[model samples]
Target: MNEVEGRGLCLHNNSNGNLITPSSDDDLRNVFHQIRTTKNPAVINYGASWCRVCSQILPSFCQLSNKFPQLSFIYADIDEWPESTQHIRYTPTFHFYRDGERVDEMLGAGEERLRDCLWLHS
Candidate 1:
């Protein structure tokens, strides 16, 4: 992964390349707002730091992001953002959005399936 500094923020390509980790609720809200306003395709990985499966698929997820620069990738740790992730039933749940609407969702750490979903949406 690479770290790029921008606007005073040390933006690092987490396990998922191009992934952004919002430090606060406001930051998270802004990310969603930007996605909606820009109507860009985005994928959100709802995972937890303590989840073994979440950790296992991260490398592949990051590689997938690098493969698709047109898509916005984000990581939300359920442990840190419980209120925002209450609906999540499992770790490594991926939510795909396009044109400001969620088009598909996949649960679990299936790297191949995730890549296919991204290919289809992107």
Candidate 2:
């Protein structure tokens, strides 16, 4: 079984679903930069507190992260970090980055898409 599967993460539309009050502009940049430093692929879930899909699927995302320690997982609150990801057109967006560069992306918090994203990168 794949690592994600081993952790009980289903890569299907099972739907899912951070608060950082950035003290200053530098704090926001630093957080972004820190996540970008991972040599392995990084997964960021851009979600909102009120999003139902996010609520459903977030546990799976965290399980996948735990199953694969080689990758970094970051969660962003849309309300808190508008400037950090303003270019995004959708909520509950999943992004995969490698060495500070985005290598893959998925839209929505559906299980199928998330499975595809993690499988594609994994």
Tens-place lDDT per residue, model 1, 33-76, is: 98889999999988776688887787687778888888999877
Give one digit per residue, the lDDT tens place, for model 2 in 1-122. 12221333223322121212233336656766875674556677876666778757777776666555666666665665668767767777888877777887788777767766777776
What are the lDDT figures for the candidates, one per model? 0.78, 0.62
Report RMSD (Å) for each prediction in the order shown. Answer: 4.9, 8.6
Per-residue error (Å), model 1, residue 25: 1.8
Q: In model 1, state the lDDT of residue 98.
A: 100
> Model 2 residue 111 lDDT?
72
lDDT of 1 at 7: 20
User: Which candidate leads in lDDT?
Assistant: 1
Regions more than 4 Å wrong, model 1: 1-17
> What TM-score, computed on C-alpha atoms, does each candidate reach?
0.84, 0.69
Evaluate residue 39 in candidate 1 and report its C-alpha lDDT on the 0 to 100 scale.
90
